[model samples]
Target: MLYYAPDNASLCVRLALLALEIPFETALVDRSCNAQNGPAYTALNPNGLIPTLITPDGPIYETGAILLWAADQKPSHVFPAVGNPARAAGLAWLFWLSNTLHPTLRMTFYPTKYIDAGSAPLLLTATRANLLGHFAHLEAHADWLDDTQVSISHCYLAPMLRWSALYGTDQSWFDLGKFPRLLAFAKRFEVTHVADQARLAEGLGGTIFSAPTPPCPPEGSAT
Candidate 1:
């Protein structure tokens, strides 16, 4: 198998691959350099996104899809094979992170494209508020999104939280203190062999290195 990843989105998939102990060659696509937009990369994924995986079957994009496919390929602890409640729960959180949290963070950090220049500030403010609200919601539950002991959701969320700090989104937004379980969970995941290598490869500067807010709480909670 071959993987095309950038410095950002590909980290999770790369970690997943490493966690599964699968050996694959990496094609590093530099997004800042506009390599992903070139004709060659665009032919692989029309959307021109990072972390595209070329398996014997074909190419796959999107972090969630790549992780799930990797899980299915290995069918071990990272993802259980059949009739595992934890697997279903893990899948739920994975999808939630991909569909919900990831999009919100993307908008909050890069809102210039969606709104007029005059109203961009307002849009960003609202987006940040919405993200905080979500963080508060996640803070209320202490089970790490899914009720699993360990799963793909943690891998997906780790990078998001890392980037949140980079965007200076305010640590209090997610109430990190209240979600001790999640914090410990993240710390434990960080020390894993694969996580260490992935962090170095992705240039994360070694784990957020400080406590940040937990995942946002569910909506409509006291903040």
Candidate 2:
């Protein structure tokens, strides 16, 4: 498999595959250089998104979808098997993370994308409040939602928390300390080889998180 990852969105899938002991090569797409919009990368993921996995059959895009596919490749604690109640729960969390939580963070980080310049602050405030509500919901149900052994959501959530802390909003507003379980889950990956390598490769200067409010190019969105 050839993993086409950009700055940092690909870390989730890479970590999942590493946990499964899967060996795959990487084709780094330089989002900073607008590589994702280039003819080659766009041909792979028409959406011009980061982290497109090239499998023998075809390509897979989207962080959540790629993480799910990677976990399904082998039987492990990272994901529950099909038809199982736990599997159903996993799917729900993955979808929530992608559709609901991720979008909120995107808005918080890049509020300018959703509204006019003069009203960006108002949008950021409302969006950050809404995002905190989502975080509170996850925190309230952290026990069943987070896996001590590490799971697909962990890969997706950790970076989100990191983004929450670093984005247009400050950490004081969304204190990670309030979500101990989720914070711990994300922190576990911080010290791992997979996390460090992805961070360094992306020039992230830290853990596996891209620019929360990176400059706009001819394109928009880090996902």
Candidate 3:
């Protein structure tokens, strides 16, 4: 079972599972009532994160961990295996997506969690700049970013682009066109069967990555 909320990090894991065509179930972690903080959900993921994938072995928390575990289940083009020459590069970018890029986005999305609300604007300014740098770096150096193959990095990155556009206090700063390569990638990936499945599941409307709109989920709120 995948504990998820619409438009949350869990969406990334969902995309990976769909791409691999794996059979699984999902339980909505109703954010509207702070359900993630409840005892039952916390028992599975102490962090109370949106996504916690329950497996035969045990429960796996963390979006990146769940994605990697799912990819490793069988041979697939989405993820490179341990011995593949591309695995090192792929793993490096995957961790970079998890550790570096994702946290930076969190800082922007929930500024009050990191600092005082009155000073959030200043923090957003600096953080938005940092985000621009991150995107530019990926555009120039991330050879692993491929629109055709749709690697695990694609699952991770396309959502970051979506959230960056839709989440922050000031979404105007993020312009997909500035990074043409990533823009192209989003345009391509959004139309794929994998992305489309996630779109319908989460009520994420058309152009979810390249031109995202606020989510309108069927069962629970995106917040």
Candidate 4:
């Protein structure tokens, strides 16, 4: 399998591949040059999104789908088991993160794409409020994020916390004290060699902190 992912959201699935301990090739989709918007990438994912996994069978798009597929490739110990109650719960959060939390994040980070320049602040403000609530909800389950037996959701979430710290207006929203368990887990994940491999493969520097801002706004570009 070939993992074609960019930075930011790419870490979600990239980390999964690492955690699954699979042998796969990583391809960099240079979103900074609008490479993801080009025809070559679009042919892989008609949606023109980053993070499309080209499997031997076919291309898999969507963040949750790719991560779930990664989880499937490994033993049940890495991901939730089929038909287990945990499977349902994991799917719920995965869907929520992709469908709800991620969209709100995009709006907060790059409001200009979602609203007119003059009105961007309003959307940003509202989106910030929404994101805070989402964080609070996650904080409610901070312990679960670092379970000894990690779930795919845990892999999916680490990147969210990292990005929240980097680009958010109020970094305290992800400050260690308030969101220790989840934030700490994410920070640890970022430093690991596996994380570095994924980041560097995408042309992001060795540490995620050293990664440059994407050339253009990625907000409202995908769900």
Instruction: Say which candidate scores most in lDDT.
Output: 3
Give model 3's TM-score versus the native structure.
0.97
How far in Å is the alpha carbon of 202 misplaced in model 2?
Answer: 4.5
Cα lDDT tens digits, model 3, 1-223, are 9899999999999999888888889999999999999999999999988899999989999888888998898755688998898788878889999999999999998999999999999999999899899999999998766648777789989999999999977888999999998998899999999999999999999899999999988888878
* Global Cα lDDT for candidate 4: 0.68
For model 1, how does the per-residue alpha-carbon lDDT over 62-164 read when each residue is reduced to its tens digit?
8899889988887865876667766676667678789988888877666775777788778877887887676666667526543444456677777676666
Candidate 1, superposed: residue stretches over 4 Å from native: 1-6, 145-150, 168-179, 209-223
Looking at candidate 3, the ten consecutive residues that score lowest on lDDT are 143-152
lDDT of 4 by residue, 61-172 (tens): 8888888888888758566779777777777888888898887887777788788989986776777778878888887854566675556777677666656656745554
TM-score-better candidate, 1 vs 3: 3
Residue 209 of model 2, lDDT score: 35
TM-score of each: 0.82, 0.81, 0.97, 0.81
Q: What does candidate 4 score on TM?
A: 0.81
**Judged by TM-score, which candidate is best?**
3
* RMSD of every prediction: 7.4, 4.5, 1.0, 4.6
